[model samples]
Target: MNSITLEKWSDVVLPIPARYRAVITRDHKILFHETDMTPFINQDQRTFREDFMMYQFDGDNIISIVIKDMPFPPTHFDTFTDGTLLLASARCVRTDDWIQKNAGRYSLDGECLYKFVLGDGISAVAIDDEDTIWAGYYEEGVYGNYGWDEPIGSSGLVAFSSKGEVLFRPHLPMINELYYLNIQKANSIFAYYSLFSAIIHLDHFGRVQHSEIEEVMEVGPITIINESLITYDYHSKLLWSLKKQEGVYKKDKAFALKDQEGNDLYSEESAIRIRGNWLFVLNDSGIYRVELTMRMLEE
Candidate 1:
């Protein structure tokens, strides 16, 4: 029943009606594939398409990139450092003779520059300035689901080069699946995985350091703010926060989110995305945002 007030970051005027595939950039811009269909699920069992458009809205300028030869519907996408895009689908199945390659790189003009297999049940995908791809998988991708006798993401985390070449795979036999991770643009990685609630920080030099926030678990999509960990409160359908100060942990708390006018924020379950210190919510109403700060932890 507790409520947290948030400062609005953007307008409710949704530019594209295809809200399911929308993504918000760190700078507050919006990007999404223009479609009316659901996302993350296999489209092969539904509507298959040979083409689609990716739209980016930056301020008043709109950039549209038309892609040909769509591979299942894209479940995750990230822009490369060199302005290209790394887009991939979630589900992949093997039929006789032909294998499904669901991930690919596309140019700004929407050309299919390269295609690769990122495995199945991919939960998250991120890229850094070095053009290194860090893909996180769920239980299915880690446990030989989707016709993969040997899942490519057996480690639950896989790093690939710009050309889809495997670069590094860590040996964390404890983690059964990757839950959430923040792979910063600088190649610094902070991840929360299954069976282990402790956050792991992976540096560029191949060193591993378990973070100090083991007090906080993957209750939902994880977000780091100052010295606190935040996720969603499934019951309240709002923000949940956990704080660590001076190496001491605080009890977890949940609170509802509202705008300056005290309007309630909408929750569509899968439409919530937390990045760095920002929370983005998508709905038919539009994209809403809130900044995560120390104040949220106090409430």
Candidate 2:
């Protein structure tokens, strides 16, 4: 069996542990949500739940992260610029003041602010090249004949402007359920959907690209490593890679195997961000690095 090597980075225990939803702005930044059991005491019958949290870093020091305040719990958050933060939850959108006393506020006009409620919640969000907001639906579906339905039904990929105007909503294949989706930089967007046993890619227009399994890796969490697409599988517990180079694409299988130094070739339950020949995979345990190679798959 071929083995992949994964070296330990940092296992800094987070203040509140939660599911590793997805990472944004590469391994340099990450986002997660924590729910507090405190019930809303107001007459509105709203649950006073603390939803989202973002951990910021300069290298590995964890410079800043949004924590819970008194009445409101941070729902979802993303750093659009070094000074600006776009934060959200299920009901409302707000801009966080980095210079202020951590007050969750929006400088944008209130008339421009709209109630952006998601189906399950705002799964993933990205500002595309056109300054449009690309939000991925946070839902799942079953595979094969027993259950071949997606959670959002026809709402696979949805696009909106900065002012919260719904721009484009397109449907994907009925069998394909969204797994992990995000915007690559701003020019091109990537969406992964499970067609039961396999995964496929959908462009910004919600059009399915190459459906062949050999052409793309199966549905799992993915990261952009330079020109390659990397993913980790929890079931078989293996790591896979696919390269989309100058008009050509290829695939490679990676796993955890020990070298002379007792390091792993890859990581488990981690997020990988690849640039050039270097790959960075990080989890609660911390970040790791690996060298990658690209070769033509001979027929």
Candidate 3:
């Protein structure tokens, strides 16, 4: 096992209760969403007032903040090639008469570019190099439950043009939670992972290139670094490399996380984002920058 170093600890101060999603723009700007929920019980009908706030950061300084009030909470978001924002909002509760007007394109200044409807609940979104937007949906199973323990019904992956036109919608298995979506720019493939340990790869044309169902692991976010899948295991507190061999993923490496003094760093509610060669980690303690150094094992 390789040892890792987490240095340059910093704090990101935001006004929201918790962070849901974060992304680094091409220009090194940090865009993130913060959410807060309030429960209300009225005549046995339970509902929540979900507040979603958007924030932008330049280094450690907060540049802008936008508190948005909408019919549903923003579930996933990404930036277009032109720096425009794409947000997907879906109803949290299962309602029979719910319409699917759940996604929107917006400018950085909080202006709505376009609004459109999807077939199911949108969980994650990504923008390809050609400016095409890809979205992942979470459809409830027969039990009328969206939890992972329930059966998986029918979900889908969608590709849309920048003009809000649906380019293609592919049939996919019911994903429990679309945790992360990324574009492997090397092959122009859009890839996404779900909480159910399913990884789906799609070409730029929205055709399925490969799909793999692996053993359940506590992986938070995954990124393709140099064509290899890199993700942090929440249970082991180690960074793992998954390389494809013979149409399956093989464990390439494992790097254990430690502080400068060699103390183990663990957190269950941590989030990770990779920019260039550095990995940014945020947990309940603070934000940290992790650098991985590999050393050959000596016989």
Instruction: Rate residue 148 of model 3 by lDDT.
Output: 29
List the candidate 1 regions with Cα displacement exceeding 4 Å: 1-4, 12-20, 26-28, 36-49, 94-99, 196-198, 205-218, 244-253, 268-270, 295-299
Candidate with top TM-score is 1
Worst 10 residues of 1 by lDDT: 209-218
lDDT digits (tens) for residues 50-99 of candidate 3:
43557766666775545354444565666777877777653333345543
> What TM-score against the true fold does each predicted structure earn?
0.80, 0.61, 0.72
How many backbone clashes does every candidate have? Answer: 0, 12, 0
Better of 1 and 3 by lDDT: 1
Q: Give stretches of model 2 more than 4 Å off.
A: 1-22, 32-54, 65-76, 81-83, 90-115, 119-122, 138-153, 197-218, 223-229, 242-252, 257-260, 265-280, 283-285, 289-299
276, model 1: CA deviation in Å? 1.9
- RMSD value for candidate 3: 5.4
What tens-digit string does per-residue lDDT give for candidate 1 at 1-299? 77766555445455334554565554556677766545535446324566778877764677988887686677788777677888887776755565677789999988889888888878888776567888888999888776788878888888888777888887764767787766555446667776646555677537455544544333556666655667775555767766666653344677776666777776553366666667776655555677777765675
User: Could you tell me which 10 consecutive residues in candidate 2 have the lowest summed lDDT?
Assistant: 94-103
Query: What lDDT score belongs to each candidate, Candidate 1 first?
Result: 0.69, 0.45, 0.57
TM-score of 2: 0.61
Return the number of clashes found in candidate 3.
Answer: 0
Clash count in backbone of candidate 1: 0
